[model samples]
Target: MHRYANPSRFIRIADTIFPWAGGIMITAFAIGLYLALLKSPADYQQSEMVRIMYIHVPAAWMALFTYAFMALSSAAVLIWKHPIALLSAKAAAPIGASFTVICLATGSLWGKPMWGTWWVWDARLTSVLILLFLYLGYIALINAFDETERGGKAASLLALVGAVNLPIIKYSVDWWNTLHQPASVFRLDGPAIHPDMLWPLIIMAIAFKMFLLTTLVTRIKSELIAARVQNVQRSLHGNLADGRG
Candidate 1:
Protein backbone atom coordinates (compact mmCIF):
# COMPACT_ATOMS: atom_id res chain seq x y z
CA MET A 1 0.00 0.00 0.00
CA HIS A 2 2.86 2.36 0.85
CA ARG A 3 4.21 1.76 -2.67
CA TYR A 4 1.13 3.59 -3.94
CA ALA A 5 1.94 6.65 -1.85
CA ASN A 6 3.61 8.12 -4.91
CA PRO A 7 0.95 9.94 -6.95
CA SER A 8 2.56 9.11 -10.29
CA ARG A 9 2.63 5.41 -9.52
CA PHE A 10 -0.93 5.51 -8.24
CA ILE A 11 -2.11 7.29 -11.39
CA ARG A 12 -0.38 4.74 -13.56
CA ILE A 13 -2.20 1.91 -11.79
CA ALA A 14 -5.48 3.80 -11.94
CA ASP A 15 -5.10 4.44 -15.64
CA THR A 16 -4.70 0.73 -16.27
CA ILE A 17 -7.84 -0.09 -14.29
CA PHE A 18 -10.04 2.77 -15.50
CA PRO A 19 -11.08 1.37 -18.89
CA TRP A 20 -11.75 -2.08 -17.47
CA ALA A 21 -13.87 -0.60 -14.74
CA GLY A 22 -15.85 1.51 -17.18
CA GLY A 23 -16.47 -1.38 -19.55
CA ILE A 24 -17.56 -3.71 -16.79
CA MET A 25 -19.78 -1.04 -15.29
CA ILE A 26 -21.56 -0.48 -18.59
CA THR A 27 -22.02 -4.16 -19.33
CA ALA A 28 -23.24 -4.97 -15.87
CA PHE A 29 -25.70 -2.12 -15.88
CA ALA A 30 -27.14 -3.27 -19.18
CA ILE A 31 -27.58 -6.86 -18.05
CA GLY A 32 -28.73 -5.94 -14.57
CA LEU A 33 -31.33 -3.49 -15.82
CA TYR A 34 -32.67 -6.03 -18.28
CA LEU A 35 -33.02 -8.65 -15.56
CA ALA A 36 -34.41 -6.19 -13.06
CA LEU A 37 -36.95 -4.48 -15.27
CA LEU A 38 -37.87 -7.05 -17.90
CA LYS A 39 -37.00 -10.53 -16.68
CA SER A 40 -37.70 -10.64 -12.95
CA PRO A 41 -41.25 -11.30 -11.87
CA ALA A 42 -43.02 -8.54 -10.07
CA ASP A 43 -43.56 -8.96 -6.36
CA TYR A 44 -46.79 -10.73 -5.46
CA GLN A 45 -47.69 -8.04 -2.97
CA GLN A 46 -46.03 -4.86 -4.12
CA SER A 47 -46.44 -5.59 -7.84
CA GLU A 48 -44.52 -3.23 -10.11
CA MET A 49 -43.45 -1.06 -7.23
CA VAL A 50 -40.90 -3.63 -6.13
CA ARG A 51 -38.94 -2.68 -9.23
CA ILE A 52 -37.67 0.34 -7.39
CA MET A 53 -35.72 -1.98 -5.12
CA TYR A 54 -33.45 -2.71 -8.03
CA ILE A 55 -32.08 0.82 -7.87
CA HIS A 56 -32.69 1.67 -4.23
CA VAL A 57 -31.12 -1.37 -2.57
CA PRO A 58 -27.97 -1.24 -4.66
CA ALA A 59 -27.55 2.48 -4.03
CA ALA A 60 -28.01 1.94 -0.31
CA TRP A 61 -25.40 -0.79 -0.27
CA MET A 62 -22.95 1.34 -2.25
CA ALA A 63 -23.54 4.26 0.05
CA LEU A 64 -22.40 2.14 2.97
CA PHE A 65 -19.58 0.52 1.04
CA THR A 66 -18.20 3.86 -0.19
CA TYR A 67 -18.20 5.31 3.33
CA ALA A 68 -16.40 2.26 4.68
CA PHE A 69 -13.83 2.62 1.92
CA MET A 70 -13.41 6.33 2.63
CA ALA A 71 -13.02 5.71 6.34
CA LEU A 72 -10.28 3.16 5.70
CA SER A 73 -8.54 5.58 3.36
CA SER A 74 -8.76 8.31 5.95
CA ALA A 75 -7.25 5.90 8.48
CA ALA A 76 -4.39 5.23 6.11
CA VAL A 77 -3.86 8.95 5.75
CA LEU A 78 -3.69 9.48 9.52
CA ILE A 79 -1.83 6.37 10.60
CA TRP A 80 0.55 5.74 7.72
CA LYS A 81 0.66 9.23 6.27
CA HIS A 82 0.07 7.74 2.85
CA PRO A 83 0.20 10.63 0.38
CA ILE A 84 -2.66 9.36 -1.77
CA ALA A 85 -4.94 8.34 1.08
CA LEU A 86 -6.42 11.78 1.64
CA LEU A 87 -7.03 12.21 -2.06
CA SER A 88 -8.85 8.89 -2.21
CA ALA A 89 -11.05 9.83 0.73
CA LYS A 90 -11.77 13.26 -0.68
CA ALA A 91 -12.65 11.86 -4.10
CA ALA A 92 -15.04 9.32 -2.59
CA ALA A 93 -17.07 11.73 -0.48
CA PRO A 94 -19.37 13.23 -3.13
CA ILE A 95 -19.91 9.87 -4.77
CA GLY A 96 -21.00 8.38 -1.46
CA ALA A 97 -23.25 11.34 -0.80
CA SER A 98 -24.87 11.00 -4.23
CA PHE A 99 -25.55 7.33 -3.56
CA THR A 100 -27.03 8.18 -0.20
CA VAL A 101 -29.33 10.69 -1.85
CA ILE A 102 -30.49 8.18 -4.46
CA CYS A 103 -31.13 5.59 -1.79
CA LEU A 104 -33.23 7.99 0.23
CA ALA A 105 -35.21 9.21 -2.76
CA THR A 106 -35.91 5.79 -4.19
CA GLY A 107 -36.71 4.39 -0.78
CA SER A 108 -39.16 7.20 -0.24
CA LEU A 109 -40.75 6.52 -3.59
CA TRP A 110 -41.11 2.86 -2.65
CA GLY A 111 -42.42 3.67 0.78
CA LYS A 112 -45.24 5.96 -0.28
CA PRO A 113 -47.44 3.23 -1.71
CA MET A 114 -46.49 0.57 0.83
CA TRP A 115 -46.28 2.68 3.96
CA GLY A 116 -48.74 5.33 2.81
CA THR A 117 -46.15 8.01 3.46
CA TRP A 118 -43.23 9.44 1.56
CA TRP A 119 -41.21 10.19 4.68
CA VAL A 120 -40.93 8.56 8.07
CA TRP A 121 -38.75 8.84 11.14
CA ASP A 122 -37.99 5.15 11.20
CA ALA A 123 -34.76 3.99 12.75
CA ARG A 124 -33.27 2.75 9.51
CA LEU A 125 -34.29 5.81 7.55
CA THR A 126 -33.03 8.20 10.20
CA SER A 127 -29.69 6.46 10.52
CA VAL A 128 -29.23 6.55 6.75
CA LEU A 129 -30.06 10.25 6.80
CA ILE A 130 -27.36 10.76 9.39
CA LEU A 131 -24.96 8.95 7.09
CA LEU A 132 -25.76 11.47 4.34
CA PHE A 133 -25.11 14.35 6.73
CA LEU A 134 -21.76 12.85 7.70
CA TYR A 135 -20.75 12.73 4.05
CA LEU A 136 -21.74 16.36 3.52
CA GLY A 137 -20.00 17.43 6.70
CA TYR A 138 -16.81 15.69 5.71
CA ILE A 139 -16.82 17.36 2.30
CA ALA A 140 -17.46 20.78 3.79
CA LEU A 141 -14.81 20.38 6.48
CA ILE A 142 -12.13 19.29 4.02
CA ASN A 143 -12.63 22.45 1.95
CA ALA A 144 -13.16 24.77 4.88
CA PHE A 145 -9.48 25.54 5.46
CA ASP A 146 -7.09 27.39 3.19
CA GLU A 147 -4.49 24.72 3.90
CA THR A 148 -5.66 21.63 2.12
CA GLU A 149 -3.63 19.32 4.33
CA ARG A 150 -5.09 20.78 7.51
CA GLY A 151 -8.61 20.55 6.15
CA GLY A 152 -8.04 16.96 5.03
CA LYS A 153 -6.71 15.99 8.44
CA ALA A 154 -9.73 17.45 10.16
CA ALA A 155 -12.13 15.76 7.75
CA SER A 156 -10.27 12.46 8.11
CA LEU A 157 -10.82 12.62 11.86
CA LEU A 158 -14.50 13.23 11.26
CA ALA A 159 -14.69 10.27 8.85
CA LEU A 160 -13.09 7.98 11.44
CA VAL A 161 -15.41 9.20 14.18
CA GLY A 162 -18.48 8.90 11.99
CA ALA A 163 -17.80 5.22 11.26
CA VAL A 164 -19.73 4.38 14.42
CA ASN A 165 -22.91 5.04 12.48
CA LEU A 166 -22.31 2.23 9.98
CA PRO A 167 -23.33 -0.54 12.34
CA ILE A 168 -26.30 1.43 13.56
CA ILE A 169 -27.52 1.91 10.00
CA LYS A 170 -27.09 -1.77 9.23
CA TYR A 171 -28.92 -3.09 12.27
CA SER A 172 -31.46 -0.39 12.83
CA VAL A 173 -34.40 -2.63 11.93
CA ASP A 174 -33.17 -5.41 14.22
CA TRP A 175 -32.39 -3.13 17.16
CA TRP A 176 -35.65 -1.27 17.00
CA ASN A 177 -39.18 -1.52 15.66
CA THR A 178 -38.93 0.24 12.34
CA LEU A 179 -41.14 0.25 9.29
CA HIS A 180 -38.14 -0.99 7.38
CA GLN A 181 -37.87 -4.70 6.75
CA PRO A 182 -35.11 -6.69 8.36
CA ALA A 183 -32.38 -8.44 6.40
CA SER A 184 -33.68 -10.61 3.61
CA VAL A 185 -30.87 -10.50 1.09
CA PHE A 186 -28.08 -11.22 3.56
CA ARG A 187 -28.65 -13.77 6.25
CA LEU A 188 -26.64 -16.23 8.33
CA ASP A 189 -28.67 -19.05 6.82
CA GLY A 190 -28.57 -17.71 3.29
CA PRO A 191 -30.23 -15.04 1.22
CA ALA A 192 -33.99 -15.25 1.69
CA ILE A 193 -34.71 -13.73 -1.71
CA HIS A 194 -35.46 -15.96 -4.65
CA PRO A 195 -32.60 -16.64 -7.04
CA ASP A 196 -34.42 -14.81 -9.80
CA MET A 197 -34.43 -11.55 -7.85
CA LEU A 198 -31.12 -12.12 -6.11
CA TRP A 199 -29.05 -12.48 -9.25
CA PRO A 200 -30.13 -9.16 -10.73
CA LEU A 201 -29.59 -7.35 -7.42
CA ILE A 202 -26.13 -8.81 -7.12
CA ILE A 203 -25.26 -7.86 -10.67
CA MET A 204 -26.53 -4.32 -10.14
CA ALA A 205 -24.41 -4.13 -7.01
CA ILE A 206 -21.38 -5.08 -9.08
CA ALA A 207 -22.17 -2.36 -11.59
CA PHE A 208 -22.36 0.15 -8.76
CA LYS A 209 -18.99 -1.00 -7.42
CA MET A 210 -17.40 -0.63 -10.82
CA PHE A 211 -18.85 2.82 -11.19
CA LEU A 212 -17.33 3.82 -7.85
CA LEU A 213 -13.91 2.53 -8.80
CA THR A 214 -13.92 4.31 -12.15
CA THR A 215 -15.07 7.63 -10.74
CA LEU A 216 -12.78 7.49 -7.71
CA VAL A 217 -9.76 6.93 -9.91
CA THR A 218 -10.68 9.82 -12.18
CA ARG A 219 -11.24 12.17 -9.25
CA ILE A 220 -8.00 11.19 -7.54
CA LYS A 221 -6.02 11.79 -10.73
CA SER A 222 -7.59 15.21 -11.12
CA GLU A 223 -6.70 16.08 -7.55
CA LEU A 224 -3.08 15.03 -8.06
CA ILE A 225 -2.73 17.05 -11.27
CA ALA A 226 -4.28 20.14 -9.70
CA ALA A 227 -2.01 19.87 -6.68
CA ARG A 228 1.07 19.56 -8.90
CA VAL A 229 0.07 22.61 -10.88
CA GLN A 230 -0.49 24.59 -7.70
CA ASN A 231 2.92 23.62 -6.39
CA VAL A 232 4.58 24.67 -9.63
CA GLN A 233 2.88 28.06 -9.51
CA ARG A 234 3.88 28.55 -5.90
CA SER A 235 7.50 27.71 -6.64
CA LEU A 236 7.59 30.11 -9.58
CA HIS A 237 6.14 32.91 -7.46
CA GLY A 238 8.61 32.22 -4.66
CA ASN A 239 11.57 32.35 -7.09
CA LEU A 240 10.34 35.64 -8.52
CA ALA A 241 9.97 37.12 -5.01
CA ASP A 242 13.49 35.96 -4.13
CA GLY A 243 14.95 37.67 -7.29
CA ARG A 244 13.16 40.93 -6.43
CA GLY A 245 14.49 40.89 -2.87
Candidate 2:
Protein backbone atom coordinates (compact mmCIF):
# COMPACT_ATOMS: atom_id res chain seq x y z
CA MET A 1 0.00 0.00 0.00
CA HIS A 2 2.70 2.47 1.01
CA ARG A 3 4.82 1.53 -1.98
CA TYR A 4 2.08 2.73 -4.33
CA ALA A 5 1.90 6.13 -2.68
CA ASN A 6 4.23 7.49 -5.34
CA PRO A 7 2.10 8.75 -8.20
CA SER A 8 4.05 6.92 -10.89
CA ARG A 9 3.70 3.57 -9.17
CA PHE A 10 0.03 4.20 -8.48
CA ILE A 11 -0.60 5.10 -12.12
CA ARG A 12 1.01 1.87 -13.28
CA ILE A 13 -1.09 -0.12 -10.81
CA ALA A 14 -4.25 1.67 -11.90
CA ASP A 15 -3.50 1.04 -15.55
CA THR A 16 -3.11 -2.64 -14.84
CA ILE A 17 -6.42 -2.96 -12.99
CA PHE A 18 -8.54 -0.58 -15.07
CA PRO A 19 -9.07 -2.80 -18.10
CA TRP A 20 -10.34 -5.70 -16.00
CA ALA A 21 -12.51 -3.38 -13.96
CA GLY A 22 -14.01 -1.84 -17.10
CA GLY A 23 -14.89 -5.22 -18.56
CA ILE A 24 -16.50 -6.41 -15.37
CA MET A 25 -18.41 -3.17 -15.00
CA ILE A 26 -19.97 -3.47 -18.43
CA THR A 27 -20.83 -7.13 -18.10
CA ALA A 28 -22.39 -6.68 -14.67
CA PHE A 29 -24.53 -3.75 -15.72
CA ALA A 30 -25.92 -5.55 -18.76
CA ILE A 31 -26.72 -8.79 -17.00
CA GLY A 32 -28.00 -7.01 -13.90
CA LEU A 33 -30.34 -4.80 -15.91
CA TYR A 34 -31.75 -7.82 -17.73
CA LEU A 35 -32.37 -9.61 -14.48
CA ALA A 36 -33.76 -6.56 -12.72
CA LEU A 37 -36.13 -5.60 -15.50
CA LEU A 38 -37.16 -8.81 -17.27
CA LYS A 39 -36.66 -11.82 -15.06
CA SER A 40 -37.36 -10.64 -11.50
CA PRO A 41 -40.96 -10.78 -10.51
CA ALA A 42 -42.74 -7.65 -9.36
CA ASP A 43 -43.26 -7.20 -5.64
CA TYR A 44 -46.63 -8.41 -4.39
CA GLN A 45 -47.12 -5.17 -2.50
CA GLN A 46 -45.28 -2.53 -4.57
CA SER A 47 -45.84 -4.31 -7.92
CA GLU A 48 -43.83 -3.08 -10.87
CA MET A 49 -42.81 -0.02 -8.89
CA VAL A 50 -40.63 -2.26 -6.76
CA ARG A 51 -38.15 -2.41 -9.61
CA ILE A 52 -36.99 0.96 -8.40
CA MET A 53 -35.23 -0.89 -5.59
CA TYR A 54 -32.85 -2.30 -8.15
CA ILE A 55 -31.50 1.24 -8.46
CA HIS A 56 -32.50 2.97 -5.23
CA VAL A 57 -31.28 0.40 -2.73
CA PRO A 58 -27.89 0.05 -4.39
CA ALA A 59 -27.41 3.79 -4.69
CA ALA A 60 -28.22 4.13 -1.02
CA TRP A 61 -25.72 1.40 -0.23
CA MET A 62 -23.01 3.12 -2.25
CA ALA A 63 -23.76 6.45 -0.63
CA LEU A 64 -23.01 5.03 2.80
CA PHE A 65 -20.10 2.92 1.56
CA THR A 66 -18.42 5.86 -0.19
CA TYR A 67 -18.65 8.02 2.91
CA ALA A 68 -17.13 5.30 5.01
CA PHE A 69 -14.29 4.96 2.50
CA MET A 70 -13.70 8.71 2.57
CA ALA A 71 -13.57 8.67 6.33
CA LEU A 72 -10.95 5.91 6.31
CA SER A 73 -8.89 7.68 3.65
CA SER A 74 -9.13 10.88 5.60
CA ALA A 75 -7.79 9.02 8.63
CA ALA A 76 -4.92 7.72 6.56
CA VAL A 77 -4.15 11.28 5.45
CA LEU A 78 -4.02 12.52 9.02
CA ILE A 79 -2.00 9.67 10.39
CA TRP A 80 0.42 8.94 7.55
CA LYS A 81 0.15 12.08 5.36
CA HIS A 82 0.11 9.83 2.32
CA PRO A 83 -0.56 11.64 -0.95
CA ILE A 84 -2.62 8.72 -2.25
CA ALA A 85 -4.82 8.86 0.82
CA LEU A 86 -5.58 12.52 0.32
CA LEU A 87 -6.13 12.14 -3.41
CA SER A 88 -8.39 9.11 -2.95
CA ALA A 89 -10.58 10.94 -0.45
CA LYS A 90 -10.81 13.92 -2.81
CA ALA A 91 -11.51 11.72 -5.83
CA ALA A 92 -14.36 9.90 -4.09
CA ALA A 93 -16.44 12.97 -3.20
CA PRO A 94 -18.19 13.79 -6.48
CA ILE A 95 -18.89 10.12 -7.08
CA GLY A 96 -20.46 9.79 -3.65
CA ALA A 97 -22.45 12.95 -4.19
CA SER A 98 -23.77 11.59 -7.47
CA PHE A 99 -24.78 8.35 -5.76
CA THR A 100 -26.56 10.28 -3.03
CA VAL A 101 -28.50 12.24 -5.62
CA ILE A 102 -29.53 9.03 -7.36
CA CYS A 103 -30.61 7.48 -4.08
CA LEU A 104 -32.73 10.47 -3.14
CA ALA A 105 -34.34 10.79 -6.55
CA THR A 106 -35.15 7.11 -6.86
CA GLY A 107 -36.38 6.98 -3.31
CA SER A 108 -38.78 9.80 -4.06
CA LEU A 109 -39.99 7.96 -7.14
CA TRP A 110 -40.51 4.81 -5.08
CA GLY A 111 -42.12 6.66 -2.20
CA LYS A 112 -44.76 8.41 -4.31
CA PRO A 113 -46.40 5.11 -5.23
CA MET A 114 -45.73 3.27 -1.98
CA TRP A 115 -46.06 5.96 0.67
CA GLY A 116 -48.30 8.44 -1.17
CA THR A 117 -45.67 11.18 -0.79
CA TRP A 118 -42.74 12.49 -2.76
CA TRP A 119 -40.60 13.01 0.33
CA VAL A 120 -40.59 12.69 4.07
CA TRP A 121 -38.38 13.61 7.05
CA ASP A 122 -37.81 10.06 8.12
CA ALA A 123 -34.69 9.08 10.04
CA ARG A 124 -32.96 7.18 7.24
CA LEU A 125 -33.86 9.76 4.62
CA THR A 126 -32.71 12.65 6.77
CA SER A 127 -29.43 10.96 7.69
CA VAL A 128 -28.65 10.13 4.09
CA LEU A 129 -29.34 13.78 3.16
CA ILE A 130 -26.82 14.83 5.76
CA LEU A 131 -24.30 12.43 4.19
CA LEU A 132 -24.78 14.17 0.84
CA PHE A 133 -24.25 17.59 2.42
CA LEU A 134 -21.12 16.33 4.13
CA TYR A 135 -19.65 15.29 0.78
CA LEU A 136 -20.35 18.69 -0.71
CA GLY A 137 -19.02 20.43 2.33
CA TYR A 138 -15.81 18.42 2.24
CA ILE A 139 -15.31 19.23 -1.43
CA ALA A 140 -15.81 22.92 -0.78
CA LEU A 141 -13.49 22.90 2.19
CA ILE A 142 -10.72 21.06 0.34
CA ASN A 143 -10.70 23.74 -2.35
CA ALA A 144 -11.15 26.65 0.01
CA PHE A 145 -7.51 27.08 0.96
CA ASP A 146 -5.08 28.11 -1.74
CA GLU A 147 -2.41 26.01 -0.06
CA THR A 148 -3.17 22.43 -1.02
CA GLU A 149 -1.77 20.84 2.11
CA ARG A 150 -3.77 23.12 4.36
CA GLY A 151 -6.90 22.41 2.42
CA GLY A 152 -6.29 18.68 2.66
CA LYS A 153 -5.79 18.87 6.39
CA ALA A 154 -8.96 20.83 6.93
CA ALA A 155 -11.02 18.58 4.72
CA SER A 156 -9.57 15.49 6.36
CA LEU A 157 -10.65 16.70 9.77
CA LEU A 158 -14.13 17.45 8.50
CA ALA A 159 -14.42 13.98 7.00
CA LEU A 160 -13.47 12.34 10.27
CA VAL A 161 -16.01 14.44 12.13
CA GLY A 162 -18.72 13.74 9.59
CA ALA A 163 -18.27 9.96 9.93
CA VAL A 164 -20.72 9.91 12.81
CA ASN A 165 -23.56 10.31 10.33
CA LEU A 166 -22.71 6.99 8.65
CA PRO A 167 -23.77 4.80 11.57
CA ILE A 168 -26.81 6.97 12.03
CA ILE A 169 -27.74 6.39 8.44
CA LYS A 170 -27.15 2.66 8.79
CA TYR A 171 -29.33 2.12 11.86
CA SER A 172 -31.84 4.88 11.39
CA VAL A 173 -34.66 2.50 10.58
CA ASP A 174 -33.82 0.36 13.55
CA TRP A 175 -33.50 3.21 16.03
CA TRP A 176 -36.53 5.23 15.05
CA ASN A 177 -40.02 5.03 13.69
CA THR A 178 -39.25 5.78 10.10
CA LEU A 179 -40.74 5.44 6.65
CA HIS A 180 -37.80 3.33 5.58
CA GLN A 181 -37.78 -0.42 5.99
CA PRO A 182 -35.23 -2.36 8.02
CA ALA A 183 -32.39 -4.39 6.54
CA SER A 184 -33.36 -7.18 4.16
CA VAL A 185 -30.12 -8.26 2.48
CA PHE A 186 -27.98 -8.36 5.61
CA ARG A 187 -29.29 -9.65 8.92
CA LEU A 188 -28.51 -11.92 11.86
CA ASP A 189 -30.32 -14.87 10.30
CA GLY A 190 -29.90 -14.33 6.57
CA PRO A 191 -31.24 -12.35 3.64
CA ALA A 192 -34.98 -11.77 3.72
CA ILE A 193 -35.24 -11.15 -0.03
CA HIS A 194 -35.82 -14.23 -2.14
CA PRO A 195 -32.79 -15.52 -4.08
CA ASP A 196 -34.54 -14.59 -7.31
CA MET A 197 -34.66 -10.85 -6.49
CA LEU A 198 -31.37 -10.93 -4.59
CA TRP A 199 -29.18 -12.13 -7.46
CA PRO A 200 -29.89 -9.19 -9.75
CA LEU A 201 -29.52 -6.73 -6.91
CA ILE A 202 -26.17 -8.25 -5.95
CA ILE A 203 -25.00 -8.15 -9.54
CA MET A 204 -26.03 -4.48 -9.85
CA ALA A 205 -24.23 -3.68 -6.63
CA ILE A 206 -21.08 -5.28 -8.06
CA ALA A 207 -21.48 -3.21 -11.20
CA PHE A 208 -21.74 -0.04 -9.16
CA LYS A 209 -18.66 -0.93 -7.15
CA MET A 210 -16.62 -1.66 -10.25
CA PHE A 211 -17.76 1.59 -11.85
CA LEU A 212 -16.73 3.56 -8.79
CA LEU A 213 -13.30 1.96 -8.67
CA THR A 214 -12.60 2.77 -12.31
CA THR A 215 -13.70 6.39 -11.95
CA LEU A 216 -11.80 6.97 -8.74
CA VAL A 217 -8.58 5.65 -10.23
CA THR A 218 -9.00 7.89 -13.26
CA ARG A 219 -9.61 10.93 -11.07
CA ILE A 220 -6.57 10.18 -8.93
CA LYS A 221 -4.41 9.86 -12.03
CA SER A 222 -5.61 13.27 -13.18
CA GLU A 223 -4.78 14.81 -9.82
CA LEU A 224 -1.33 13.25 -9.85
CA ILE A 225 -0.61 14.68 -13.30
CA ALA A 226 -1.67 18.13 -12.17
CA ALA A 227 0.56 17.89 -9.13
CA ARG A 228 3.49 16.77 -11.26
CA VAL A 229 3.00 19.75 -13.56
CA GLN A 230 2.97 22.10 -10.59
CA ASN A 231 6.19 20.61 -9.25
CA VAL A 232 7.93 21.00 -12.64
CA GLN A 233 6.94 24.64 -12.82
CA ARG A 234 8.24 25.26 -9.32
CA SER A 235 11.54 23.56 -10.15
CA LEU A 236 11.94 25.60 -13.35
CA HIS A 237 11.26 28.80 -11.46
CA GLY A 238 13.85 27.89 -8.83
CA ASN A 239 16.49 27.18 -11.52
CA LEU A 240 15.83 30.57 -13.18
CA ALA A 241 16.15 32.36 -9.83
CA ASP A 242 19.50 30.61 -9.16
CA GLY A 243 20.82 31.52 -12.63
CA ARG A 244 19.91 35.20 -12.06
CA GLY A 245 21.55 35.17 -8.63
Q: lDDT per residue, candidate 2, 188-235, as tens digits?
A: 999999888999999999999998899988988888888889899999
Per-residue C-alpha lDDT of model 1 across residues 29-146, encoded as one tens digit per residue? 9999999999999998899898899999999999999999999999998998787899899999999999999999999999989999999999999999999999999999999987
Residue 219 accuracy (lDDT) in model 2? 88
- Model 2 CA deviation exceeding 4 Å by range: 242-245
Off by over 4 Å in 1: none
lDDT of 2 at 171: 89
Best by lDDT: 1
What are the clashing pairs of model 2?
Answer: none
lDDT of each: 0.94, 0.92
